[model samples]
Target chain A: MPHTVNCQIDHLSVNIQPGATILEAARSIHIQIPTLCYHSDLCVAGNCRLCMVEQVGADRLLPACATPVTEGMEILTNSQKVRHARKVMLELLMSEHRSDCTHCYKNGRCELQNLASEYLVQDGRFIDLVPFKNYTIDDLSPSIIKDDAKCIRCQRCVRTCAEIQAVSALAVAHKGAEMKISTFFDLPMAEVVCTNCGQCVTHCPTGALVEKNYIDAVWQAMDDDARHVVVQTAPAVRIALGEALGLEPGQIVTGKMVAALRRLGFDSVLDTDFSADLTIIEEGHELLQRLREVIRDKNPQVKLPMTTSCSPGWIKFLEHLYPDLLPHLSTAKSPQQMFGALAKTYYARRIGMDAKNMVSVSVMPCTAKKFEAARPEMCASGFRDVDYVLTTRELAMMIRQAGIDFLSLPDDEFDSIMGQSSGAGVIFGATGGVMEAALRTVYEVVTGREVPFDGLNIVPVRGLEQVKEAALTISSPLPEWGFLDGVTLKTCVVHGLAGAREVMKKVADGSCDYHFIEIMACPGGCLGGGGQPMPVSDHVREMRARAIYRDDAGKAIRKSHENPDVVKLYEDFLKEPLGHLSHQLLHTHYVARKRY
Target chain B: MNGLRELVSALAQKHGTRRESLLPILQGIQAHEHYLSDDAMVEVARALDLSTAQVYGTATFYSFLVTRPQGRHVIRLCRTITCVMHGKNQLLKELETLLKVRVGETTADGLFTLLETNCLGQCHQGPAILIDDEPYTRLTPERIRVIVAEYQQKAALESENSGLINS
Candidate 1:
């Protein structure tokens, strides 16, 4: 057993592990020390010295985040000296920070603003206004915006991009107070190899970085007399939107969200889950076709270990980092794009309205969805399939702006036809949900039996693990898929971009011998996207995952092929999966990007 | 690749291509190229198995290493407290007049580049400046003209030698 170290914090003697920091040891005993740069999910940065504490017999105070707990250590977390020093630090931070909080995107959600109010640091009149560099705010990217004037040099976004995502689009270009977060040569994010996963925005403490707001355009579409605005919600939005609107983390408020959208003047409220089911049908057949070519025909041209293309961030990652292997990616568009295409083409045609008159909008937990929708190739409906993309935070702001009491609103149902979805669709919010959903349908279609996992859950692929691998043996394959009979269908799931890097490296070396791979760019998949609620932690992500899985389990229909609306869509409009019409509306291509 | 890039590639080959060799490799590139180019940084990143942004980050953090193209001669004027107290601004003005270029700008002919340094670590020297790693201490206005003429004569000699080789 490891030896426990005894330490005292604010006169309370506690035993903590040796590796624990002063902040962790204090928190272990319920002594809450304030912090700005210390995040529960990221490595200790220690740049923001808000957690300064006085040590007995030591002349200088120590930062609790970078300092480890030792035996017989006596630290005063709330002494006058420590409090004064923290106040001084806050004053210094505010001196350089742009305090236009009322107009800022992170108005009520900013951590620095909260700490300033908590410490009552109104002024540092002793110091004059310091000279600082004036930088231009970069709002060119469709997904995220950067305001250098508001950055406090926390490096949370920098660490998240480099350490977690392995993209490293942002870095510290210069040193000292002149130091600022920038891309290579300070290029705009739109020109960089940014996946726009938004983990940076999720962990940012201030309004320096945030998702591009589309509330105004969405509201303008609602006000347009010539247009009938329809909104679609992603699977992850329902679970996490509650937290932005002051509800608990795990609260499933799908119905309330639809009701609020209706009140905001959207003509119809639909669920992207319906199209998520559609994606499975198209992507599953695509996977099976590739498998036949590779295993049965023994075609060397077809790339094995085909990766899922549901995540736009992962798609962009491949375009920049591994463009040569783009053939290995499935040609299916994401559920958001698939829903947009159908909303304008299939649903609008059935309703006897012009596709141009119907406005298809998306409410997503991802920032990358904005960029994905803006791609010129997403015009399968002869118009821009997705007119506007609103983030989960933007949707909450709309609800609040319309004066709708979100929590107390009556639970409402989505519109019929295009709104119907299966349990497989609802689980698309979590990490391995797509793989599980695909296997649920694929295995049943082949063997005429449920997946061997307990309660239809593919347990091996369903966790917060960075990389998950599983294999399934096709004991009794369908007549058409006899080539796969007796052959083990190996699969893997990679959640974060960092994990995807490792998997891609293995694929390149021909070492990882998996047949199918699912890649989700965000840490906990779509639930931990760059556009989620503030103060996100592992526990927050876990709560979102639990709610997504619960929503899935509660659905009566759990398979994509079993969805009644999807079957009717094939009968009335689509005709068949991956047919001429489906390919035109449901698939897209990617171009290689410069890696600078 | 250009001659400077070839020189950097040779330098990396000489000093084993490893992560720790990044600083020395960057220094070698700057020494030959007078600045670090993006292509050199990318090549170094690939050689060291690191990211290009990370390589650019380290190269930009140091004050001595320039990322943009510099002149044939780099003139650094120390603006430390001691220098400022002892008439450093006058020497800066004199150098600007003699070179016909302001601070942080290169001459039209690309012969001289001027910069303001933090300190020369010779604080007691009062006012000082360094030209291409050579220090000129306790300067006067007359000394500025003499330093410029000396560098100009050396540059002219180098051009004559290159012209002879080309012919």
Candidate 2:
């Protein structure tokens, strides 16, 4: 059934879809309405009166952004009266806002900049500069740069941080025009538990929030001859790195990227996918052991629900939002951590080199990895395993600085032992890839049969949806295995901190009970990480997501339990999943932070 | 002895509920508790399928909510950029003199606990102070004593009434 929404605009007929908003309809028909305190992604705050439009026979003009298109609604978007009101609103906002965009990082890309250009406001008629009496610029957080001078109080970054990523890292502290964003305390960003996911940066229309790029740090590492620098690339980095090279979003440049890294003086170029497979090996066994405990004991006291701990952003969210469920999180170090720990220990030792001589660097699509590397417990090899973390964009900058042609480089291969990876490892770049990878192994281990689905593509858990859930039944007859039939395996996957928060609330409240859950702190998984290329688009997310799938399809081994190298690591070195060595190296605990 | 809770309870009783309802009747107990404790929140939840967890979740999630009991004199300092630019440091120095405690520490008298908040949403106030739930704009060290005295006087008056009611 097609529902027509009639928006009567000065006696002219306008038709819209059932759920289309008046602001959206006005936009489609090229209606010019001024808005100062309204953003498309943010919730309708209705604080600024910029987008106020006059409705026929009404005493007051309604906010176009907040007002939905209703039948028989007559709106005058561009009347002289509306324009006057909008101009006054903009003038008032300008009086309060710091007009320093010329030297600001968000100079050309600012929404306020575009609006000022459209409004053609030469000067502020009002001088209502509210001076803040007390405050300091908190530069504690490692990955985000916050400048409150240019804040418009739109609350877009706050909402993006809280609602989109479920971090609640930023919030409106005071009331009225005096309202400003803040963390737990007036602590520096570095001191706070911000995952630095950069979703806030992407959502922020101004330069108030930006990434803390480590391009200079990487350059220093490369320049040092005594430091044997090794760089490993995450799967999602290749797809979005081109954006930093002035290529269109979603342009694939894997070959060019490797060549560029080589030119940048990395002694050994490795792949993070290799360690991703290593994670699968350890994590997959952990899941199998948990399943065995469930089957053998038949006790509800057993921790049935084991959540995936691949994403540091998700891990921090759980700590803050749902601290009680910390034990449920798999104690496996993330693939990046595993790679770093091994690069300093196993790789360095195998190559007959000292750990101090090797400078391990990771090119990731995640900002959380930066914070993760800094954790006091992550120094597994008695040193900061990863010395420096570079975003995909930062790597592109390095390539550009090297004067290397990024678009025409030859394809290259990673180094021998740590370079080998499987399709399961590559899929870890996407949201549900971790869940699917774990399932391929656990399903086979428990049932002792091949995965019924071809390609092991668990369709139910796939895609860029905010939350994905699926329930599967463990097949019949394992009397020798002491397992029961028709055991429903309920699993839920949440991507984006906001969506993860929603599911977390249910879990925290003991509602929507599920046996397993997967959470990624960034939207669209690692492909949309804070470390990904700037000015991320839907096209880039799609391309990177596709690249992950392609990498998965190209590999011969698609299951973590099937990786012979991983099997050998456990057999020879680690001994078992919950072994003393595995726990020592791979697992760690979390402490509940006091917000007060 | 302190009379803040008793005063609030008497105020609530005068309005139409028991003194126990003062936490809810006053500016929600969240302002005093950091987050509403299970016992306190359950009392609020009894009226509404709202389990203890639901109430706890809301109380814990929001920054404004105080789930734990706060000190007698709660000083919420705005440490965000707006306040910083407005000489918040001077105000903090004054607060330290008045309370004899640093930010994030409670006074020896147990009368005040100084806390630095992200933003008070009072950016227009520049440096602002929230003494309990009431916000004072454009604050300075000189103005702290007067604000404290005003609240203290009211608390004293309320305590006299609480004694009469109990008697």
Compare the candidates by TM-score and give the number of the best one: 1
**TM-score per candidate, in order?**
0.97, 0.73
Supply DockQ values for each candidate. 0.71, 0.07
Report the lDDT of model 1 for residue B7. Answer: 76
Cα misplacement distance, residue A142 of candidate 1 (Å): 0.6
Candidate 1 lDDT score relative to the true structure: 0.89
Candidate 1 contains a number of clashing pairs equal to: 1
Instruction: Assess the local accuracy of residue A145 in candidate 2 as a C-alpha lDDT between 0 and 100.
Output: 82
User: Where does candidate 1 clash, by residue pair?
Assistant: A198-A530
In model 1, the Cα lDDT at residue A506 comes to 90
* Candidate 2 residue lDDT tens string, A417-507: 6776778887787888888877777677767876667768887887888899988788863565446366777899888877877787787
Whole-model lDDT values for every prediction: 0.89, 0.73
Fill in the DockQ of model 2. 0.07
